[model samples]
Target: MDFQHLSYFIEVVRHASFSKAAQILHITQPTLSKIIKNLEDELEVILFNRTTRYIQLTDDGEIFLKFAHLTLSMADDLQVSLNDGKLLKKGKLSLGLPPVIGVSFFPHIIAKFRDLYPGIHLHLIEEGGKIVEQLLRDAKIDLGVVVLPVDERHFDFIPLVERQLSLIVNSNHTLAKQEIVHLSELRNESFILFKEGFSLNDRVREACIREGFEPVISYESSQWDLISEMVGVGLGIALLPETVLGRIHTESVKVIPKTVPQISWDLAVIWSKHHYLSHPARGWIQFIREWVWLQRSMI
Candidate 1:
C-alpha cells in the first residue's frame, strides 16, 4: 500500500513475530496488527500464517515480499536520482565496517574525510564482515568494507588492504625467538581466534586445514584486542595481520612473520551493484582510492 506498510511487513517477516516487529518499529502491537489486517483486507489475501508465538509467510505473502522489496528499492533509486545534484553540497553516507577493520584502519581515514568534507554526514555501522556482506545484499547501507573475494555477481569492489597474516606469541613462549614460523610448526599449539562471523576466522581455519591440522582453538572473540590479550596471558598463540599487530599495545606478545602456505588478510570496499550508489558514496570511494595510492607511493 505504502512504503511504511511494505517496511512494516518486511520487518514482521524478518523477525517472524508480530510483537517483535512492532517493538522494533516503535509502534504498539495492536496498531501494527490493525495495519496489517487493513493491508490484508485491501489486498484480499492473508499474508501470514499466524500462530500464538510466531508467524510464517503464506504462498501469497512470499510472492508479495519480492515485489515489496523491489518497490522499496525503486523508491530509494528515485530519491537518489532526484537528489543527485544537491548531494554534493551536503549529504549523508552509511558505511558498514567490521570492528576489526574499523579499529585497524578507518579512524584516521574518517578524520581525514570529515576534515575534507565537513558537510557530509558519515554514519558508521559496525558489524562482522559476514553481517556487513548481508547488509550490502539487503541494501541497508550505502557501502561497506569487507574481506576480499566478495560475490562478484552481485557487487562491485575495490581492493584496499592486502598483506599476509603474522603470528603472535607470548614473549616467553618457545616460538618467540623465531623471526618466521610455518603453519605446520604450530600444529601442537593452542590458537586464539576471531569468532565465526569474521572472515579472518574462516581464513585461519582453512589455512590450518590446508597445512594438515585443525588448530586447537582455546578461545574465540569478536574483538582483536581481546584475542591479543588472550595471547598476552599465554592462553594461546594467534595469527593476525601486521596492520593490526602494529596498532596493538602489548609487551608480552612477539610478532613473527608467517611462512609456508601464507594466509593473506585482504580487505576491500564493496557496494551492491544491484542498488544505486549515491554521489557522496562515489566521492568517498574515490577518496579511498587516492589515499591508498598515496600510502603505497610513500612506502
Candidate 2:
C-alpha cells in the first residue's frame, strides 16, 4: 500500500469531513475521494461509514488507523534520520493555539522560530484550550498551546507560563480602587466572560461556585478585548489573564489582583504521548524549553 495514500486516509478520518481533510492535505475533494476509493478497493473493506452529518470509521478502519499512525510516525522519523541532522529543511507544522496565546506571545515566538527554520511551513488554529487538546488527540495538529492541568498521563507538556487572573471593572465602579478583590465581594456582580468551551470560562465559574454564588454572565465572547470593552462600559466585570490585559488599552477599566481563591492558568505546549512528533515539532519544544525559558531567566 502506498504510504502517501495511507496518509490521505488518515487525514480523512482525522478530520471527519472530506472537504476539510482535502483542504488540509492541499488536494481537491474529488481527488481525495478517489484516493480513499482506491484504498477501499485494494483492501476490500469499507473503511468509513458516511452520512450527511458525519463520516466515521468502520471496524476495519479503526484497526487500520492504529497501523497508519505507526507507519506515518516511523516514516517521519526515518526522514529525520536520513537527513543527517539537518532538521527542518522542509516540513509542515500544524499547530493549535488558544486565542489568549495567539494574541499575546504566539506571533513573536513563531517569528523567531521561522527565522531559525525558514523551510518549515506553519498551519495554525486558534481555538479554546479544550478544542486545541482535542485537535492534538485527533492528529489534526502537530502541537498545541493549551492551558494546563491537562491529562498528563496521555500527553507531555512543557509549562510556558502561569498568568494571574485579574479582576477588570469600570474605572468608576465601586470596586475599582481596591488592590485585591475577594471572590465573595462580586457575589452580585454580572460578569462578561469567554464562551463555554474556554478553560477560563469554566475556571471562573467553578471558582465563583466555590465562593457560594453563581456568577451572573452578562455577555459571552471569544475576544478578550470585547470582554474588556464590555466591562469598561459597565456592562459587567471580567476576569482575564494579566498577559492579555497588558496587550490592550483598557483606559476605562481598572485591573485588580484576584485572591480569596486566587485564579490563574498555567500555559503549556502539549502533544499527545501516543502521536509521532516530527523533528520540527520536537525541536520547537526544545527551543521553548531551552531558549524561551532561558530568556525568561535573564529577565
Q: Output the number of the TM-score-best candidate.
A: 2
For candidate 1, lDDT tens digit of each residue in 99-129? 8888887799999999888878899998888
Any idea what lDDT model 2 has? 0.87
lDDT of each: 0.88, 0.87
Clashes of each: 0, 0
lDDT (Cα, tens digit) per residue for candidate 2, span 1-299: 99999989988988898999999999999999999989899999989998657999999999989989999999999977658334667777888887877888778889988998888888898889888888888988889988878998878998888787889999999999999899999999999989987889989999999999999998999999888888888899999988887865857999887667899778888999988888778878887898656768898
Off-target runs (Cα >4 Å) in candidate 2 are: 1-86
The C-alpha TM-scores of every prediction are: 0.69, 0.71
Model 2: how far residue 238 lies from native, Å: 0.3
lDDT of 1 at 183: 89
Predicted candidate 2, C-alpha RMSD: 17.0
Task: Candidate 1: list runs displaced more than 4 Å.
Answer: 1-87, 297-299
